[model samples]
Target: MAGIYIHIPFCKQACLYCNFHFSTNKKLIPQLVNAIAKEAFLRQDYLTETIETIYFGGGTPSILPTSDIVFLIDEIKKIFEVNSNTEITLEANPDDIDEANLVAWKKAGINRFSLGIQSFIDAELQWMNRSHNAKQAKHCIDLIKKYFTNYSIDLIFGSQLLSNEDWLVNIKTALSFNPPHLSCYALTIEEKTVLGNKVSKKVISNIDNEKQAQQFNILMKELAIAGFHHYEISNYAQPNFESKHNSSYWQSKHYLGLGPSAHSFNGSTRSWNIANNALYIQSIENNNLQIETEELTTTQQLNEYIMIALRTSGGINLNIIEERFGVTILLELKNKITAWLQANHIEQKNNFIQLTNLGKLYADGIAADLFF
Candidate 1:
């Protein structure tokens, strides 16, 4: 099954730690929505499989009008083979989650929501420069619980304002809502963001690695005790409630991504659109393709698979590696992982290499070390 990702590149305000391709300009919403719809029809033949998931991610997709959301979904349905049970997800911020909006989104075919709650502390929300307050966050979740069964909460840990006690409180507060899924991320400072500039100027201290690691361990322990599965490094979900769209991505399923700065991948080639909104709109209007493509070599594909699969609960499949990359390379991988195995980071169970809790913390580093 294939999936579709639509990026809405507008936001109500800028967050300190955000580096995604998004603008705070609301003036271009109508034009950008039309451009996105046009691009969708233009690239209708990009995926060969039936569409099983449609994810609206962004600069906060919930900021769009219900009419815009409906128009795009209708356009997509007319051009593609969408499944009856397709999982349609919209990433929303707490400030945009009023009851009226929730009702409209439901009618427009949004089956799931990924809320950017960030933190439950009022001071933390202010520190992050989020548009919503603590009360609004709780109220929005309450509204969602009444109407939606499959919803996810996003929380950030290791922030300057969040102590270890506050981190525990944040996780427990999220669990209080009994959400089906939770996506907890560490607040990493990117060079291009406001937070990064503060660190670079020495206005604030850099991330304390030990403190961050401790918070992550606390997260793993708390979530495990609460009966949530750590399916991906940054994602946790209850049984049968994992995000189909995001999971499809990790499994390397074919998908079409529409809008500025969005990436698409089939089995062999991957492509992305222009990051500039005006430029992307202009190219679509002129019927000019503004995307760049790359052909993945065998080693590149294997390394990519190794990087992604190791972050997941499924771990790496040695049999599939041998089949796809030949026995020589698979033997090399086996030899490479010996030290990791001895260090009690990763363990092989029935030929599948899964990470221990300790391994999860250094997952990315380990994946890079194991790359071909």
Candidate 2:
């Protein structure tokens, strides 16, 4: 199955730690929406298979008017074979989750939501310069549960201002809603972001790796008790509630991405639209796509497979690797991972190799080491 990702590069305000490509200018909303719809028509043949998922990712898709969202969906349906049960998700912030918008979103064919509830702590929310307060974060869940059964909330851990006790309270507060899915991410200070600038100027302390690791352990243990499956390293889901769009990404399924800074991937080639919204609109108007294309080399593909699969619960399938690559490559991969196996960092079952609890801490490092 295939999927579509539409990047709405507009936001009300920039978060302190965000490094994503987005503008705070709401004036470009109309032009951007029309451009995205045009892009869908232009790239119709990117995926041959029926579309199973459509994700409206951000800069806060909920910030748009409901009518615009409906129009985009209708435009896509006109050109693509969208599955009747296709999972359509929109990313939202707590402040935008009013009854009016929620009802409108449901009516516009948005079956799921990914709420950006970074933390339920007022102080932490302030530190992150989030648009919503702690009260809004907690209150929005009740409103959301009333409408969408398949929704996910995002939480961040490892901020210097967040204590272990505070982190526990945040987790408990989110669990109180019993959300179908949770995506917990570590707070990373990316360059060019406000937090990154503060750290460089010594305005704030650097992140504590030890503290982050401790919080991750707490998240895993608590979520497991609450019956959430840790399907991916950063994602947890209740039974049958996994993110179909993201799962398709991990499985290397073909997907078409529209709008500024969005990416697309078929099996052999990958492409991304220009990050500048003005440039994107201009190019679309000129009937030209401002995108860069790359045909992945065999080694590049194998390395990518290793990186993605290793971070997942499925780990790396040796037989699939052997079948797709070669037996020689599989043997070489096994030999490369012998050290990690001996170190008790990874365990192998009949045909799958998965990271152990201890190994998960160094997942990126291990995955890099195993890359072809």
Candidate 3:
């Protein structure tokens, strides 16, 4: 099944660790929403299969008027073949969620939510420069629990202000709500962000790799005990609540992304839109798509597959690799993973090779080592 990702390139405030393409100016929001709708129609023929999921992501989709969100969904439905059970997800921040907004979002056909509640500690929220305070975060969760069942909330571990006890408290707080899905991410300072600048200037302490690793381990252990499945390296879900849209990406399914700085992928080629909001809107209005495309080489595709698949709980499918590449390539892979297998970093079960907890610590490094 295909998927659609609509990037809302505007936020009410910028978080310290965020580097996503967004404008704080609310004046252009109306134009931006219209531009996004236009882009959806422009790229309607991009996907061949029926759309099973539509994700409204970044800078803060919940900040938009409910009417604008419904307008975009209606536009997409008119132009594309959307499935009856399509998973429509809107990424929301705690501050934007109120009873009225939740009711409006539900009316707008938002069946799922991805809440950005980075931390439960007020100090941690301040450190991250997140818009919402701790109290508002909890209050929103309470409101959401009353209205929605299919939702996921995000938590950032390994922040300078968070201790292990604080991390446990944060996870426990989320567990107290019995959320269906959780996306726990280790904070990594990306370039061009305020956090990155702080690191460069020694204005703030750098991320301690050991501390991050410890927190990751803590997250995995806590979630597993709480009966959450570690479906992906960064995502955990209870039972069948795993995000279909994100899982499609990990499985390399075709998806069309609409909006500035959004990326689209089919079977062989990938493309991305221009990051500038004004330029993106201008180009769409002018009926000239501002995007770049690239064709993936066999090696590039294989490496990409290895990178994504290895991060998942299903691991790498040897038979699929053998069929797509060759038995010779598969044998080489088996040989390459021998050291890791011996070290118990990875384990082979039937045709699937999955990572062990020890291996997960070095998942990226191991995937790179096995890359073509």
Candidate 4:
């Protein structure tokens, strides 16, 4: 099964740590939406299998009017074959979620929501420059619980302003809501963002990797004790609540992404649209989408598989690697795994190479070492 991702490249306000492609100018909303719809029709054949998920992700899909959202969904349906049980998720912010908006989104076929709650502390929210306050965050969760059953809450950990006590409170607040899923990410100061600029100018302290590691450990321990599956490195779910769309990506399934800065991937090829919103719209209007495409080399594919699978709970399936790449390559991988196994960084069971709790902290490095 495949998935479709529609990027809505507009937000009401810019967050300090955000480096996503979006414009605060609301005037381009109409043109952007229309261009996205056209893009859907243009790239309809990118996925050969049935579409199992359609994710409305972006700068902030929650800011779109209900009618516009409905129009885009309808347009996608008209052009593509969506599965009956497809999961349609909309990434929403706390401030945009109200009773009326929730009802409207449900009517527009958004069965799932990935709410950006960030933090429950007012000071933390202010520091991040999120548009919603702490009160709005709580209210949005309450409203979502009342209206929807399948939703995920996003939280950020490892900020300099957040103490251990504050981090505990954030987790406790999320647990109080009993959300089906939670995605926690450590704050990374990407270059060109406000937070990055502040750090460069010494106006704000940089993120502490040790503190971040501590918080990550705290998260894994608490969430596991709470009976949530640490399904992926940055994602947690209760039972069968894992995100299908994202899971498809990890499984190397084909997906088509529409809109500015969106990436599309088939098994052998990958492509992405230009990041500039105005340029994207103009190019599409001119009947020429400025996209860059690349065919994946065998080594690139093997490296990608290693990177994504290592971050997952199931780890890397040795048999699949052997089958796809070759037994020689698998043997080479096994030698590397043997070293890690001796170091207590990895465990081999039933031909799968899974990470140990301690090893997870250095997952990226281990994956890179194993890459051919």
lDDT of 4 at 326: 98
Best by lDDT: 1
| Per-residue lDDT over 1-372 for candidate 2, one digit per residue giving the tens place of the 0 to 100 score | 999999999888989999988999888899999999999988898889999999999898989999999999999999999999999999999999999999998998999999999999888898899999989988898999989899999999999998898899989999999899999999999989999999999999999999999999999999999999998999999999999999999999999999999999999999999999899998998899999999999999999999899889889999989999999999999999999999999999889999987888889999999987
- Please report the TM-score between candidate 1 and the true structure: 0.99
Alpha-carbon shift of residue 164 in model 4 (angstroms):
1.1
Model 1, 1-372: lDDT tens per residue? 999999999998899999999999888899999999999889987997999999999988999998999999989999999998999999999988888889999999999999999999999999899999999999999999999999999999999889999999999999999999999999999999999999999998999888999999999999999999999999999999999999998999999999999999999999999999999999999999699999999999999999999989999999999999999999999999999999999999987998899998899889988998
Off by over 4 Å in 3: none
Q: Which stretches of candidate 1 lie over 4 Å from their true place?
A: none
**Prediction 4 TM-score vs. true:** 0.98
- lDDT (tens digit, per residue) of candidate 4 on 205-282: 999989888999999999999999998999999998999999999999999999999999988999999999999999
Residue range 96-188, candidate 3, lDDT tens digits: 999999998888889999999999999999989899999999999999999899999899998887899999999999999999999998898
lDDT of 3 at 69: 94
In order of listing, the candidates' clash counts read: 0, 0, 0, 0
| Candidate 4 RMSD to the correct structure | 0.9
